[model samples]
Target chain A: MIRLERRKEPSTFWRVANPFLAVILTMLAGGMMFVALGKDPVTAIRLIFFDPIFSAQFGSYSRPQLLIKSAPLILIAVGLAIGFKANIWNIGAEGQYIMGALFGAGVALAFFPLQGWYIFPLMILAGAFGGFLWAMIPAILKTRFNTNEILVSLLLVYVAERILAAMALGLMRNPDQPGFPGSRDLRRYESAHNAELIAGTGLHWGVVAALVAVIFAYVMMTRHMLGFHVRLAGQAPRAARFAGVAPARLVVICLGIAGALAGLAGMFEVSGPGGQVRIEFAVGYGFTAIIVAFLGRLHPIGIVLAGLLLGLTYIGGELAQMMLGLPSASIQVFQGMLLFFLLALDFQTNYRIRLREEVRR
Target chain B: MILGSINPAVLLAALMVAATPILLAAIGELVVEKSGVLNLGVEGMMIIGAVTGFVIAVNTSSALVGFIGAALGGMVLSLLFALLTQVLMTNHVASGLALTLFGLGLSALIGQGYVGVTPPRTPKLDLGWLSEIPFLGRALFSHDIMVYLTIALVAGVWLFLSHTRAGMILRAVGENHDAAHALGYHVKRVRTLAIMFGGACAGLGGAYLSLIRVPQWTEGMTVGAGWIALALVVFASWRPWRAMAGAYLFGGVVVLQLNLQAAGVRIPVEYLSMSPYLITIMVLAIISSGKARGSLNAPGSLNRPFHASN
Candidate 1:
């Protein structure tokens, strides 16, 4: 028989090791799934986990794509980690991201045919503000009415999706192409474009913002009174209240920061890589960021590393889809498996397994 | 007045059809929550059931077998959750979310080949004399077996929770697991069974969508029904009969919105489509805020992980 003994202190070794262990487990399980799909599991696994970063065939092209993909994930995850620290769940980052894109794109479209150096910067602020505004719904509702944030925030994602469809079909539709339901390609709009800061390197303002967010989060978490209160609130709500942490204020602050950062990610994405406010504008970055937060163990620097790793999978999953005729959903299943293993292995950090004999009473 | 173009009988019938999926899913969740476990994976389990039921029904040419397959499929997925949260000691909320992501991906993969393929038809019950009963016949008796089964299940659940010895024990576990455990009850076992039953019901709900409602396997087809069902539990205040009422009410909104869109009632299609979700949020706020006593109905150990150390 096996018994689990709770540890007084979580094992630091296991905390560091479990994520890597989870990754390995996900690979083995994912390979088996590929085999079930009637494909060569070995090649599938190699392509998804290794080929993108190591192979000569796909590495160079996929390398830059990795940073592009990870940027938004890292940025959004940084904000989510803060709210999660305070035991506040804001799973509606996807909705916030959508609203941010709409707001940012609205600015550019309103300034159509105009050229100004300040336009892009103004759009960035608009994007952040849009996300903050969307997030404030749940924040205000939760603070005022004592509603559940998770359901309220998540419900808004569907609402946001509908609004996005409306914009694509009506408000934001490109007049230049009458029948096409999309906005003017912002990439070709020189004045409002989020062009590469450096040629061929995929370095953009979004990457820089992600890095700044990382550094800022690291500083705030390590050296701020609010950070202390956040941790205290998550660990002990009653104690935190006694220590003068206003739960309502913290809810607003955490949701605001998360909303702004997610909005910024959405803004940078629309301005740079995405370049259009279409029906499919909001991908699953907001939801994926939740996984990124946990895989990184809710730490700032760890989120960066975790984001890059998931980013690699995104590029590699695409590559695998192209090369092996693998279905795109396989990658989603792969990410889900990765999360499962991560959660399952987390047991190791807080408890130790011991083999023992059962004694009958 | 704007609803003049719509037929009340047809709309009421459509409401029953639309409400079945959420009603079935919510009733099962009611049991799970009553047993003190919160599984936010109703969406995931439903989709898995949808795909599995579709696949099995298509291959076997039997809708009944398809539903059984869907329930089994959902049970298997919830077992994974039980393993994670119960045996492996993972966080319930995180595990539930992971289950959803995994379920969506897995279902898509399984459903790739089955897309656009038609499954066998599910037949409605023939209540001979009741079939000719005016408007009530079309709105109520016209549904297939699952509709009556769902209502029966709701009544069954109410009886099970309030009348039976097992029901009392389950509620006891939900109200306070530590006390239940001290009283020599198997809290984990009771919870696991409740979770499995929930999965089966959610799966049946999904199969109902694929087999009777939309009657097709579309990717991400359940939309936000699962989440809405989760909210329904709160709206019903954890009472089974109230959950049925809440489901029908929400379903009425959906049918009304669709009818309005079809009637071209001047409202944008997008706004009409978004009304259900917005209404849900409004209802949640009102219910949660107005009845301070309502919070007491939530199981005391709803989301808490339980471990028995001998």
Candidate 2:
């Protein structure tokens, strides 16, 4: 009987091809899910994967929307990918994102009615600082106390969400609107608003920043010493230690960067499409970014492309929800399936599929 | 309202009831993690358990059957997790996260029909005369059978970890899978079993929420309860007994918050609502200080993937 054996080094061919193979499998499976839901499977599949960027009827508007929607996902995922590469799991980017919005909105709300562009920049900085501060909690705890960062960071998400609710209903409630559980509209604030520079297109500074993040991330992973350390630590922790990569420092750096990026994404969202702070401002983008990071193979360019592809799904998923009566949660399941299949197919990298010999009884 | 002195005793009872779900789930998770599997899908499993238990109980009118259904539902989900992370050697972290996501979606789908449907009440186990004693009876003896079962589970798990041969083997596997594998201990089987056990406990916890606590089905009823259980595990320092204490502490915080709200305390409802989560962070920070010190029982291979080559 043929038996499977692992290679000393992984196959480069399968390393790249697996993701593509997984995507095709996911599409076919996801199409089946749509069909099972009673919609025309082909049209539904095209809507989810193709229509957003290709169909002449929707491509123009959807193309720009793709960039707009992907901004937060790419920025946050790029930061997270570094940590994932280092085997540091920070599952509370959603919390960091909320804290960033809270802090940035606090700044913008403080400077309301002032028509200075500096105010907007200041708010952005504050947002980033807020997320950084929140993230540092887990980082410091993990390094200093040997506490599990996974638990620490993730639990903080609930706290952040509750704080957001408090701010919306109590601290940040609009003075003009009575009994409404939301904050002042940031977009309505002349100086601090993050509106589009071009008409009809949703392109904003946030999208530009995401593109910049992609470039920086690409460089950092390929050329920076820290990136190598991250990869080293994840692949072989003992070997990483031999190379003088400090685990504590790596944890702090990865967490700090991730928190800051998530924070900036929050700030941009609060200023841009999200428009204002509300109890429901968080739409699960932080969690969704994890999928983006993995789907992109944790490669910066791949993350950028993956973020856009995911963005397309978000838009198209909504379209199908309205037009075809498809449940929106299917989109979440579909995203989850992609990760699951991507992981299951990873066996190909190390071991070949072969018929197994019977074990000695 | 009964004109009586402030029922600190009754208040404590509420705390115990509130903490049961977290305690049960965390204690179960503690055992699983001891065997070296980090199953973050507890939240997903719990929610499915919640809905499944609610649906079954509503239809059949039996809390006991509902608990069984919840456990089975959770086990079914765990099977998927086992297939991917154990059999396929996928990254445990990603797979667990995916399991959680799938659980969330599947629960939402399963809960569609059950939303707003009322579940039959979980009958409290009246411990006869012991339950009638002024403070002790009300606070400790009087509760649903599941609550007592949870406390028993904690003690049972604690005993197993400290006293049993199998426990030692399970611990050995978590500490060093390669060595355990060489010793002919079925590492994958142990981890998979632990994961299933954890899933069942999480399902029971979810059932408590639907069948007793809220007594109704909901879309996202378990909300961050699974995450809270995860935090409880760390707070317990991965010890079965300490998990009980942490869950109770968290439960006390929750009960007190609701009490304050009922009393119309001046604090914003949001801050009051956030008290449990905020306290969790504070406690985590305090415990996590000094060194990355985990419990002695914490599995050595907690997040590592095991592979054998001859």
Candidate 3:
């Protein structure tokens, strides 16, 4: 019989190795799923995992799309990881993101037909502010009224979506295109446009912001006192309180930072790839970022890598849908499997498995 | 005149149908919480159930069999959660979140084939002469079997948690797992069973949505109903009867808002659509702000993974 024995301290080797192991396991599971769908598992896996990066046919187009897809995910995940580190769940980043897009779009629309050098920077600020303001609803409620942030944040997502739909259909609707439910395409607008920074590389201001956020998070997590407090709070609340770490303050700060980052991502998306404040403006990026945060082991650098990996899956999954006749939902299931295996195999980091016969009577 | 157009009996009947899915899911979560496990994957499980029930009912043409399929699908999905948190000792919150992601994806994938397909009609209960009786009969007895089943489950859960010896043991296990373990109670087993029951109920709730509520298969038919159910459990303070009441109240709000919208009320459609979520958050805040801690009655061991050995 096999038995698991608890370890005094978590295994450092397993801590690092488990994520890689989980990826391999997910690939295998995904292969089986493909086979079940009456496709050749090997070709499907190869197309999804390898072809996007290496193949001459799809790689050029997909490689650029990878960065485009990952930028917002990385940016959002970086903020989420900060709050998650303090055990403050901010599941409503999606709402913050939508609000940010609206706020940024609202600014651009307010200055419609006006040419100004300051427009872009002002829109960015408004986007961040909008997200931060939306995030405060749950943060204040949680800190003051002791409400659960998870539920409050999540509920806000639905509210935000409704607001987004309203904006697309009513207030933000493009007057030029009567009867259509979408705003002016910001990409076509000069001052507010978040144009690609480099030719054909998918490198935009949002990508730069994501990179900066990653570096900023890395520095804060490893070299700052607040980071220490966040870690301490998550690990032990009582001990943190004794150490003079204020829980409410931490909650607010974490939520604020996360909201701002998510909002910035949304603003960038709406002005660049998304093009307008449409009905489906808020996709599952906010929710997917949660998975990215955990998959990255809540580390800034790890999150950067996780974001790119997940981004690849998004591109590759689309490719599969188009090329292999695979269903779109398969990619979601594939991503879910990664988290499931990661969590399941995390057991190895904290415990040792042994044969039952090895135990002393 | 707007109020005059709305019949009280019809509104009440609509409210009960709207409430049944959430009521079923919340009561299941109530038992899970009472046994000291907080399974946040209700949304995921419910979605999975929704797809499974829809697919089976479409193929088999029996709503009863569809519900059973949904329950089993939910239970099977939740077994993964139980294995991860209960056996592997993973974090409940993270695992639960992952479960939701997985369930949503899985359901969407399975539902691809069933999209736009109308489900076999779930027959409403025939109370014979009782149906002729006025407002009470039409409002209470006219719902399909699942609606009545949901009400019965609430009573059953109340009795199981408050009066039965098994219920006492489940509560004891949740209150303090270590002490219960010392008393030779199987903590993991009890919690696992509770988790499975919660999953089944979530699935049944999902099935109801597909089979009777919406009565059609859509990619994401549940649309945060699971989250509402989760909020309802907290608002009810983990009591089965209160969960039912909270569900009904939410349902009433939903029905009222939709009716008002249809009647050309001045309120924006978006605002009306968002009222249920907004009100839920408001109620949660109010309850939590009270002198009593919102989660005071929460099982002491809730969210803490149990391990038999050090």
Candidate 4:
């Protein structure tokens, strides 16, 4: 029988190879799922994995969408990766995202018809602050009252959805369209609009922010003292304490950063692609970012690549939905499978499977 | 009579029904936590159970078979979690989250064709004389079998954990897996079984929602009931009876808020709708703050991954 033997140190080769292996495993499993669903597995796989980027008909439209879809994922994942490294879980990024959109849009609407450069920057600040404020609830509770941040944050997501619904239906409803439950289109508001920076490339301010965040995170993880503390805290909590690393302070900082970034992602999405604060404004980007962070191995550069890969699936999944009569939920299942495989494969890095004779058992 | 518009007996009965699902899930989770494993995928498992139960009930026209199928469905999904967290020794939090995501997607896929369809009705227990007794009967005795089963389950869990040797062993493993392992107990096996029990309970609770509460299939239903159940376990301080009390308290709040909305009370509908979650946060804070040093009654080895080494 095969037994797992612990490694003295994590294997570098498997650390890199396992993600690829997980992806291949996901593809095979996802193909089987498609077969079970009564679809041609090969065609479904090709459509989801290949046709989005390779097909001449859809490639042009989808290639740009890749950036649009990935920008929020990368931005949110970068911040989340930092917190996850510190063993602080902020499961309420979705709430923070909603609050951020609400805050940013509130500013835009409050200063309606205002055409100043400062308005957009002010909205950006409000967006980050909104997310930061929302996140502080769990952070303060965890720090001061010893409450579990994970459950608190997760519960807040539902609360945030309610607030989002309220805003759409009452507070931020477009007056011109009395019956409609949405805010005025931000795209038409030139000053507040997070317009594409380059034509037909899907490069918006959000994408630029995502890139900068990736670079910043890479630098911090490699060079900064706080990043070292974060890693130390996760690896050895006692050692971290002995080194004078304040758990409460780390909790606050990590949750704060994650909230702000997720909020920023929400703000950018609303101003650009989403265009308005509507009842259906949330698109599960916050939740999906968690997968992106894990898929990236919680590393900055890896997150960028992971985000893009996931973005491709989003585009491809849509294409599949339109052409092959596949349900949109399949993509979600596919992503879940990817994460499952990745986690299951992670066992390889810490242990080696070896066949040994029955010794003492 | 208290509120002029709301009937006290009706409110009480509604509260009991409202609390049953979370109560069942919470009791199950309490056991899982007591065994020192935190399975955060209750939401996923519950939804799987909900859809499976609904589909089966609709097809076979029997609520009993639907409930069983739902439990099996949830258990099967949890086995994947058990495999990952137990055998592979993956991070519990991540694995649980993955299970939820996978469950959600899979349930939605399975339930695609079943949406808008009514499930077979769950029969209410016929209590003849008992159900006819004044206001108390309507408030308590007039529920379906599952509600009584859930209450009995809580009592059974309490009895099992306190008096049974196997339960003692399970608790011992949860409190200190290494120590339990040293004492010749299979910590992993115990936890794996405990996790499956949690899954099965969550499934039954979910089936109650689809087959009895709503009696129809809907995508992404049970919005945050699983999370609320999780909170209930914490509020209960890992005690079975306390979990039931917490569930009833939460259920009362939910029913009261809905009643207020129906009566056109002053509070906005949105705020009223969000009250349960906000109240949960407050309750959590209060419960957590009560203990200064560490978590209140939490299993010492909760959320820790165990790998046997010789």
Chain B TM-score, candidates in order: 0.98, 0.95, 0.98, 0.97
Candidate 2 lDDT score at position B167: 90
For candidate 2, write residues A187-257 as lDDT tens digits: 88988888898966778888888888888888888899988999999999999999899999999999999
lDDT of 1 by residue, B15-58 (tens): 98899999999999999999999999999999999999999999
CA lDDT, every model vs. true structure: 0.91, 0.85, 0.92, 0.91
Cα RMSD (Å) per model? 1.5, 2.7, 1.2, 1.5
- Docking tier of model 2: it is medium
What DockQ class does candidate 1 belong to?
high
Instruction: Give candidate 1 misplaced runs (Cα > 4 Å).
Output: A357-361, B290-292
Docking quality (DockQ) of candidate 1: 0.84
Q: Model 3 compared with the native: what TM-score?
A: 0.98
| Isolated chain A TM-score, each model | 0.97, 0.95, 0.97, 0.98
| lDDT of candidate 2 over B1-310, digit per residue (tens) | 4223347888889999999988878987898888888888898889888888888888898889999999988878888888888878888888888888877876776677777877887888978999889899988888989989899999999999889999999899888999999999999899899889999999999999988988787777887898889878877878888899899989999998888877777888877887787788778766665543544445678878787775
Model 3 off-target regions past 4 Å? none
B180: Cα error in model 1, Å? 0.4
- Cα lDDT of candidate 2 equals 0.85
**Model 3: CAPRI class:** high
lDDT of 1 by residue, A1-361 (tens): 8888777899999999999999999999998998999999999988977888789988888877888899999999999999999989998899999998889999999998899998899999999999999999999999988888989999999999999999988898999997888898999898888888987767899999999999999888889998898899999999999999999999999999999999999988988899898898877999889899999999999999999999888888899899999999999899899999999999988888877754343
